[model samples]
Target chain A: MENFTTKASAQPLKNADELIDSVETFIFDCDGVIWKGDKLIDGVPQTLDMLRSRGKRLVFVTNNSTKSRKQYGKKFETLGLDVSEEEIFASSFAAAAYLKSIDFPKDKKVYVVGEDGILKELELAGFQYLGGPDDGGKKIELKPGFLMEHDKDVGAVVVGFDRYLNYYKVQYGTLCIRENPGCLFIATNRDAVTHLTDAQEWAGGGSMVGAFIGSTQREPLVVGKPSTFMMDYLANKFGILKSQICMVGDRLDTDILFGQNGGCKTLLVLSGVTSLSMLQSPSNSIQPDFYTNKISDFLSLKAAAV
Target chain B: MENFTTKASAQPLKNADELIDSVETFIFDCDGVIWKGDKLIDGVPQTLDMLRSRGKRLVFVTNNSTKSRKQYGKKFETLGLDVSEEEIFASSFAAAAYLKSIDFPKDKKVYVVGEDGILKELELAGFQYLGGPDDGGKKIELKPGFLMEHDKDVGAVVVGFDRYLNYYKVQYGTLCIRENPGCLFIATNRDAVTHLTDAQEWAGGGSMVGAFIGSTQREPLVVGKPSTFMMDYLANKFGILKSQICMVGDRLDTDILFGQNGGCKTLLVLSGVTSLSMLQSPSNSIQPDFYTNKISDFLSLKAAAV
Candidate 1:
């Protein structure tokens, strides 16, 4: 709803070459745009190799907080693409980076309501943490008036994509925020509709975030795709202007809106979550700069192919 | 907020005898009014006995679904009070009665996101149920794209005070409501704020209920305090007019508002969660018909004492 420019009309690329010529940096969303489920989409490796041959700076930006950047870096090799851990910026990485930027205390621990990815990142950033799935927090114990334990060292409560979220974890996080004075409530992502598979779309990590928000009546600092935090982090670290970057993603809400928020051009690919009809729908406020059938469609304009 | 009347001003009980004379039925809220934490309040047994001797029908109604009415009956005996299981109308009891009233199918099972109370009540009513603390649902397994299994015979999903509520249970219950056609979503309570101790107020079963509601975007048939379901059930079975009943509770929100909704007299007791300052605050909408420092304050006017 902000005063932002769309690409005049949502149309097919007439000159993909002209758009490609204008952008030096390419930001790609991982889930649907690169791969569907565990399998890589067709022409992904070739597309990455082609983009690199053209001397374009490629970066993989994902809202998946379940995996560390290191884990995601390994995923690139598994998908037959050569990429560094530095180029992969997951929500967990963004959360750790943001915490580092704010000069979060090394002595203080963060209580976690997420998976191992966020934990790994925080550890790499030199932070101590407690209460994840591995802890006894996830086990069922329904005794009357279950005493909620607390940690004095917990300075922040971080929530991400946690399959292991339970009453005790929520209670732990709520108590940490309420009981601990000046405790920071941080969420890794806020994707409303996350795709499990092409057909199955269950509630995302945002629902977990929304639960805490509802109970504590507090807002979380979401350091994910749609938030401008990632964009700022990317720009500051890479020394690239926002206008020099173009975001390519499958989902409209997080990926497209994220690019729009950063003043970067966005390309919506149909190989993932968003259908072509979603882009055509006039009710959608988040419109991308261009629409294509697949991420591989840009391959037609590649100089290496010619 | 409706066309209901307030006590105008929370005044001191000048004529306790006169206020006590109006209602034939006495409904008491268990947790703060009768008992504080695990221990029964001082003079609770004596006051209850005196009220019963006065030819007043006494009933214990609570939103807590952790213990069954039979279990609650044992607690009453432990606390040195003569209370029958029939005299207790816990949320679990209410849920069972409501299901019986609707003639819930014995063939269909209810998926539970709660404790043993509702499970016991449902079993007593000859209804099948699955998934509680004892069931394997509350434990966490963070495998990617974990397939959500479903019970084809699940006709309803019941939520209560689940200390073991996790993502899988929430998702399982959600899938039952969303995927299974005509599957009812039932909640034992909708307590906005519940506490273990007076000093601590954490997210209650309502927060667990809220997670499913937020995910499925479905409203549940709430069967607890502040809802008219228990009032209707008590009125029909006991053959007493709503006006004949007087509700005594510590909290203004659930107990007082429930009494007000049923057109019954409400007595706010200071022996529990609601403080005197809370009643005096104009910001609070619910007000009691009569207020005393403690439930035992009426003992001063008792004939046994006289």
Candidate 2:
């Protein structure tokens, strides 16, 4: 196990061809690396193709739980990429995988405070789930003689990135955690801001999860980045060693730290929310193993070397 | 200045007649001490009548921001208690008062993430406001080529106990705080939970505020209890002193801590969310100066003394 506590001095990976040669598998974070919102990043498809030709296994690990693996596969197709659903390890899938890993009772239902992705993933996983986009229009009117109620069958509340997030969902999730005995509070991820568009920042899943944390006063069992659940799941299912995997992402807190926590080599890219000043700031203690302009820099650097 | 850091041994105030006689003003927390939901606590009207008869100035200080001082005054009338609007200092009113104290520019508009009480309070305080119940039905569809827009005129975003809390409000607030230069984030109160009904726990203002905190990654300027903004407002507006005021309430974290933070004599009533076990627990560091069954205990203890 690597001592992640001691920060690795992030060096420029532009000249480090040997580092890339040693890795058999590459784990990617979507949104910033593959594309920025609706548009694909330049040279992403070519870089991925090059990696595929070199017999390197690729896994798309996204903290955005708004889309399931199937949806992500369609998105890849729309972006002119040939990524498959089998290689996409989205956070939405992680929630279902987490429940399956624990051998959750068949009768015990899950309450979702997310989007269609979480609901669809849970359905595919054969778990009875309720309360996601359906609860979007629900209102808790504190009228005279009004009483709030919760479903007793709710064994776990899965919180994710929800654009339809409202008070009813927040209160419902709160009730389950506070009232239900041994009810698990699970968070997809705690990313502060996500690249919703190439133009500006958008509130992430952490904002929705924060409401539950504040109301219930309980920390959630996060199933997304920085959590070893996905890493262990991938290791068991795909038979990949941590040393052979390199985690490439843009964010320091979630993406870069996720790799370091999973004992995988980390590469920080500057194409997303992070900047060079932010990466090198003394306050930023989470240092990645290598730094580059973007994932496509692999192709650019290799071409320049030739 | 009283050193509230050292825990004061909370004594049963059943026989503390002198403490009652010395207090010229009594600040009461309405929810647990006066009423539970719409039902008035036993002998609450009589207790207030007795306090008024003794020439004690009564002020209702509530952390619940769902109601403005005027709305709270109406609630008092509905409960058969004669608490005028002047006597009520709600957290919503505190938000408006905070803006007034800061001498906020008249041209700037305020964005609200709360109930009508906050909107009404801001209106009464002579501030232009938008985005409360109106934004409840709004949705952020992450469709192809979608863009989220926010008001540039928004100078402050006031978050309170909002039942209509949704992702639109969360995203707009996040944008204003993160994108706009020096845009203030104001929270009415950060109470973990509120007694929406005597039956169960309802998510409080903190839950809504937590969304903004998580998304914006900025600490809000809290104007509610334990912030001292309301305390100073009451002192200046009503010519009251902390020494002459006895703060009575049910919740230890909010009401009791608010009193202590304001340097007022504190009393904890067991009629609300807290239990005797929770209060007496060694881990409970927030000790009130006194403890009793409820506000009606003042009368019961007096009768027992006779």
Candidate 3:
């Protein structure tokens, strides 16, 4: 194991051979490094295969909450990649796990503004569900569900991506928050937008969470990447040393910054957010240790002589 | 003009007639009293006609920025109420007017994330437009119009509502704000949600403006109903003494609180957000001088003999 001093000048490493000589575990970003918009990047499978052959453990971490680990595993398999559900870490899982770790009451209701992934995870962890419509053979009434019940009994309010978000949902959530000022408010991620079809699209959860903060004047505890909680959770789950880990990701703000803050070496992949031009002018805050054109470039590396 | 001292135990007037007798100018909340979800409230035409017969001047103000004065006037006419555009005051209009009065660069560019009404108002006042769809129509570009034209260019970043908001717009807007730390950041309003479709909806501009504050760690100069800037703008625009004018609204947090802070009489209507039961609570900060079910109830009164 090696410890790089914080004052070391951030210079581009010579090649993948020199870069992998000191690292043991590889942390990969899912969205752009492994795949771009549902399409796997070229040589990603070979890169992972080669890393495994050299005795390096791999972990797939993502800030996106729209998908579950099972779904991600299926998608990776469909794209011809060898991976398992246990190897993936998602913000949705992190959120549920965090709530479970806090000894959250199982009988207490939760008001969710998201999809099945978060709902299933929370329920599996023993929390009750509250909102949404149900199909009945008789007269249908829009029961406010956990919203009305927990508007008084709510122990926590979990927020995630909901494309069908409307005013009543926002008002109900905000009112519940105002009534119980001490109730926990958690957001899966804080990304304001996501790239789709080469254009940015509105992803509402982050913005809606931001609205809760404005009304309550209270900051939410984010449980995704770049947050120390997620990093610690990962370290404990995999029995990996932080110093021997290398975070390979596309975004400098989240992926690279997470590595920098968590005492791990970081490799910036140009396939996503941090471009070559952006890396050339390094601000004091954002600078990655090594630069690679894509995650596939690391396939040529061999493990350091032990 | 007349003034009354705040008596510690002054009881609320028993009826609408006594409530109107004690007040002169009537301020009205635009949303529920004058209109409800694009349809004017019942009996509003005759209500305003009767109030005007008794020499009462009216001001229609709203914290909602989805529509401007011109749009409001058209909506009023369609709903059978005769009103001029000059009688309406929106938070967006007040923000732009206030910035213009201070001699903020009329020619400098502004990045707007709101309705067409705000853009039209800013352009009419001689400010340059910088944000929106690009010529190729592939992406929304953030090219500030006057960044290099003058030393103090990019005069201000005005936030409103834009249903089409994305990451590039926020990223660029925040970048400009970071570079020009002295550049003005003005929020049209801070209402967390606006009533729509018989439910509360995201007050578009207000939410996005909140996100910028969270990211940049800066607060904007909010120019809306409860803010003093609205009071000052109204006083100067209408040439009336602040003490003589009354602030009428349906929401206690925005309307009654606005009057309390601006040295004017406050009236609360039960047709909107605040309920009488809610007001009885000891924790409430707003207390209204008059209470009525709606503006129509107030219009039924005859003036008290001098």
Candidate 4:
């Protein structure tokens, strides 16, 4: 195995056959590398099919905590991709998996500051949950004599991507963290921005998590990419070695850092949030093992080889 | 004048007559020193009366941006205090004052992520404002093809303590700061928690501002206590020197730091948030010139001297 860890500079990946022959498993980021919103990027299916034909194990990892694995499977089906629920590692599942691994007190309830995805995952994990989209419509009247109340049984506050975020939810989460004894603060991911649609960038789950960070004056245990929690879980679940896995993604801070943190080979694709100039900028300290224009670049290389 | 700056430890404020004879002006923090929530601190009114009788100028400064100076005047009246609007310097006013000082363009509007207090101040300052309470009801649908829209002509995003804070406001403020060129981000105060009522603590504006901080990756120009914006404004408005103005408050981070930052004398009152033990802790770096049980301690000292 090559010492890709010490490599300071990212090289343009050449010789697709040689690179494919070396790696057995490929961990992919879905948002930018696989597709842009609902519209699949050109040659993605071909590239994924080529990897499948080569007897390569594939895993789709995403920091977007807005959808459950079941929901993601349906999305993949809509995109004409034959991905199974077992191969998908969304951060929503990571939150529930994290609690299960820790053996969170089954009697205590989990307070959610996220969406249906997190709620669904927690339910599937056999955990009692409260406060997600249910608290979206709840408002803090803040009258002259008003005092907010929170559940005392909440053991953990799991924060993820939530479009229905409001002051009521923030206040409830803050109270649980500040007043509740031995309460946990968990963040799905610290992604700054996420592609909600192809039109423009929307504020990410990191923004919502930041509210809790400021109010509680505490750091959360992140369960998503760049934390290696997901990476470890995937490795253990699939019986894969870190040396044989290549992480393919667009974002440097999340996907590339996740691979680097887990001691795996990383490939940077320029199809998502990052630009070629940004990746090559002098200030960019995160250097992937290989740099390419998009995921489909490997398919183009293989075709040229043919 | 005695140099109170290098006091190694906070001494019990002795010789109240001597202290009263020296300082010509007093700047007071409202929340903890004068009142907790709606209930006024014992002897606060009497202390204010004594200061006025001695021909000492008085100004009430607060980091609570939920209410404008006019609204605060009503609050003072309800509490049986004769604090006029001129004697008040709330952070909401500081937001508008800061914009006026910077000579922000009148054509470009301001987007607010706060309550009506900030909007009222902006309107009184003759500035066109959008967002704030109007956006409280708005939400992000986040459908598959959803694309968030933002106002392009927004020149600034002013954040304060808003009970109605929602994801829509956060997303809008983030978009303005990121997409709109030269859009300034302004925070009224970064207080971690505030006394929404006498019952329990509530999450402060800093939590809402943190959302923008995370999404935009930009720091806001704060226009509240500890920033010296309010101090400078009050000094210029009252024609007083920093050396002659004594700042009295309970909090160490905001009030005491504000006085120290502005080169004013500081006295800590334990009636609001800070406890004697917390103030006397070894880790405590912010030191006030005097430590007292409450604001009424000044009255007790004066009576004892007689």
Candidate 5:
């Protein structure tokens, strides 16, 4: 594969009017795009208002599976953006939706390696939650209560970020996979590490999930951005062609590559993990169709044109 | 590939005296076959003496790379087996010897993700060892002393089991691989997990090594058993015809598969991980040409006086 170079001259949309004129759907990345460490970005509300006034559909897609759509909706509402739970698509939501589409047995128990958001989503989707072995007495209660045991009735494994992972969790999960060859294995995202202040932290789900995949010689169905599953889900939900959707985010790898891989146009903002230098580097694989200084840049352009 | 099943009703050996008559070489597994839980098996010394009396060449080949040949030789010597360092072939030794054969750079630094033994072996073979990032202060010494500070000078990365792996190790190793695309990536083994404590505890090199491989999208040149590299090294070292060698071991996946893949006759012993039930089961791929209850059982079998 050839490396994509970001050319300064190829910057599209001299004004926001041109950008607004071409875009049908507006997709936003949660972290570092709309909010940073719990603080909402400036002009987010006005930006949403402008897009809404122009008849553009807003979708919040995040690689973080730690929260549910309902939780993200509340976070968005708190940030003064008018949004419904359906407009928020967290990785957990994508995972639950994919599991539901597969028609996994409702009575079959799911041993989750994630936060309450993933468990709640799966439970709402009619799956019986079988907590991991480390869940202790709670796991004992769920184990024999189901028609089958962990490895037997575990029809699917839904993995997301879990800070409480240990050896027991890995063993039990591996056992379930080994016993049931046909059982579905799903991971919210495959990002290796997440940024932390003291040091880079293990992005939990991916490591253990990857271990299972390697051991069992199986590949997990990833549900978050850059995987076509989520993009396809969005297209069907919004009834918009992929080309009509515009994915706006700050990170090039997840956000830009997500749109590019999904056949949607991508807009990169200079406010996240990726920077201009990284884009200029030989290693970067992602390139956006459009570039902006910030979300407010596009908003001010739209306002000035109007 | 089809499942392997055991051949039934082979004539029993009359005695140990008749068994060693036709045998020319003796092959042994290191971990469970020779010793278990830090204790040598009974009759091991007697068996070794009897084989030596018959002038059979003895070779101990192991998939475990955590220990070097010197360590294995010392262990075997402690167990009362008259083995020298040259007669023992650990995976680390095979890996180092294989890399040496390829004329890998002697002065360049190799990022090692394995035990001290592997690092020592690589160093003795003329490679400079750069331990994992967790080595912290120890890494500072290696960094300034690195033979090639230039971007392209890092020759290769050698991966094995490193229990103390962290994000920085993975990131730097991945960056080096990205910076030097031509740099070789070698893995001692691809085994996902190795059982310990009678299958109660499981650990393997794949977890850390796999993370780097996954991030870089590069497959490692495996030098452990079941890989032709080890067998080819053995063939070149001993000047033995491939067809004349017989690989005797207990595990079907590693030992018998190694022989079958290396074009050598396979002899499976039931004294270790694999059982008769597994041989009769419908999932095994590599079948042994000869079967024995244990390595000593071969000493009890003899060619008929026809």
Candidate 6:
């Protein structure tokens, strides 16, 4: 609250060194903070190198469930960054971790309403699953007796971003939840929209999850940023004190809220979906500890640069 | 409000004949009221015939958008009843009529997220369409630049009961609504769940509409029961007064609300989704004017029999 009304709160960073003073470990939101779509943001590589030279542990976290950590690492490598899979954390990983913590039975398969990333993580965690692209989601009539119970072994329905999402997948998911006793409903994230293009707003994973939510009349166990689930998963994985870590991202609803819920410091950058007016808006519920124009602005601190 | 607290309000109609003495118009809700699945409910034909002999105008209005009014009339004909297309009203008809009443341009197409009924109705009204099973709704990646704007001439997106709903349809519908200037969003009905089977709850057209609602963050013009749109269409088409009409159905939400909202008498039957306990429950917001075991119970009124 001390710097809530500071001039730098919605503009260029005033003191980059002061912001990083307490951030021993930096947790970054990928799509916006480090890169935009498939392109890396300006000065991101240099700023990241500076943080690495200053002995700050860097971790990349994203709600995108389309790609596994290994796949993300490959993208990072293509951008001239030496990031390993271990440095990457995704909602898919968090979902798998949460299910494992709950001792999800090995015999019962999870009905997936997502892509390959979630499947890879679930498999890595030694859990069997059904549905996804393999489901083919062959168009079926809405009439009864047309769609027979496809999978009786499904004990949970995990929904993420699925481009292959269809009526069949939704029907199967609803069936699994309504029929299977104690069937868990998990969601990677409930992001209403994704900033993929300027022409039109894209339906995020939340839309897929919303379909089930509307039909089943049930809420899902969301395992993503701003949910505290992902925050706890990261805390447990790194064994770090929340106070020593800082969450940096462009969105206030998800990334900044994740930091606030996790008891960590938060920084809001204006290079993505959020704008200066959004930060200054009175109706906004989330307020970050620090604000800046872009993540790359940190590279201007020549002392931190190698 | 005279019988708001009366015991008869929650009980089975003590005098079914007296209760229906003034009903000059009978608006029957198909599915559970007239038939279950494709089979006609026993006694429905005889009861309808009796009502017809009594000089009552019979109109079959259904929220099911899977079939057009012509197709529905054919079903009634097959069941040994003389019914015309004008005597049948469905959500799809209501949707098309609503569009026609508004004079939706014939040049701009309606992007459909429904079945043959909506398509046929739209076509009958001289409107071009770009969705349905014919669209194929080829599964596409959620990534940017992959889903090129399929149609730019869409002026509205009409959602009904579509078993062929896919990510592509959702994406296309969403794009049309978000990108196309002043694209009207319409839904046949927002039925949360349709009781088509006993095995599991089936998602209705509302589920498909829900995806667009979630993605576009917009409310649709719903054209089914309880919307007042369908009631207005029925009233205008038949030139009937609300007070002379009786809405007979099984659900308290759509059917009962439809009658109540339209200033007509309502009867909730136990033959379908709503139970006696549900009617008796104080927590229920909407209450019907009358309650019965089934629509077929009208046949048991020997004294009122024509």
Question: What's the lDDT of the predicted structure labeled candidate 1?
Answer: 0.82
Most accurate candidate by lDDT: 4
10 residues in a row with least lDDT, candidate 6 chain B? B1-10
DockQ of 1: 0.27
DockQ of each: 0.27, 0.61, 0.12, 0.64, 0.11, 0.40
Tell me the tens digit of each residue's lDDT in model 5 across A1-306.
Answer: 113455343264457778767879988887778876557778777778878888989898887776788886887778777889888888988888998887877777787776667876786787787763235222211231222235588877776665444334545666676676677778888765443221223333455455556555667788886777888898987788999888988777677878877888788887666677776567765667777767877776766777
lDDT of 2 at A195: 62
Error of 6 at B230 (Å): 0.6
lDDT tens digits, residues A1-306, model 4?
A: 112244588888876777788888899999888888888888888889999999999999999898999998999999999999998999999999999999998999999999889999999999999999999888777678788878999999999988888888999999998889999999999888988777888888989998888788889999998899988888888888898899999998889989999888889988888898998889988899898888888988877877
Ranking by DockQ: 4, 2, 6, 1, 3, 5
Which pairs clash (backbone N, Cα, C closer than 3 Å) in model 2? none
Question: How many clashes (backbone N, Cα, C below 3 Å) per candidate?
Answer: 0, 0, 5, 0, 1, 0
Write model 6 residue lDDT over A1-306, tens digit each, in one string: 111222234334667777777778899998778887777889888888888998998999999887888877898999888787999988888788888989989998999899899989999999998887887656765455554666778889999988778878888888889888899999998887775553445788877987887777788888887788877777787788889898999998889888888888888988888988998898775778878878887866435543
Which parts of model 3 are misplaced by more than 4 Å? A1-9, A15-21, A132-153, A180-182, A196-204, A214-217, A282-284, A300-306, B1-60, B64-88, B92-188, B193-223, B226-232, B239-306
Candidate 2 is scored at a TM of 0.95
Question: In terms of TM-score, how similar is model 3 to the real structure?
Answer: 0.63
What digit string (tens of lDDT, one per residue) describes model 5 on residues B1-306? 123354343222345444444445556666657766467766667677777877877788886777888887887777777898888888888778877898887777787767777876886788776764344222211232233132356678877765444434555566577677578888887676664344333445665556566556677888886777877777777787667667778777777777767777667767777777787577765567766676665444532333
lDDT of 2 at B83: 79
Better of 4 and 6 by TM-score: 4
lDDT of 4 at A201: 84
Q: Model 4's CAPRI class?
A: medium
Q: What is the per-residue lDDT of model 4 for residues B1-306, given as tens digits with 9 covering 90 to 100?
A: 112344578888876777888899989998888988778889888889998999999999988887889998999999999989998999999999999999999999999998888988999999999998898888678677887888899999998888887778888899999999999999998877888877888888889888888788888899997898988888888788898989999999889989988998889988888999998898888889998988778788988888
lDDT of 2 at B9: 72
lDDT tens digits by residue: candidate 2, A1-306: 224696767888865456679888899988778888888899998899989998999999998898899997999999899998999999999999999999988799999999899999999999999998999888777676677778999999999988888878988889888888999999998878876655667888889988888898888999999787888788788888898889999888888888988989889888877888999998899899999988888987887777
Error of 4 at A84 (Å): 0.7
Error of 4 at B213 (Å): 1.2
lDDT for predicted candidate 3 compared with the true structure = 0.67
Instruction: Give stretches of model 6 more than 4 Å off.
Output: A1-12, A141-144, A195-201, A277-287, A301-306, B1-9, B141-147, B195-201, B281-285, B302-306
Per-residue CA lDDT of model 6 for B1-306, tens digit only, reads: 111222235456656676567877888887778777667777777787777787889888888887889987888888777778988989988888999999998898998888899889988988898788786657664455444666789999998877777777877888888888999999888887775554445887767877787777788888897788877777887788898888988888788888888888888888878888888888886777778888767767555554
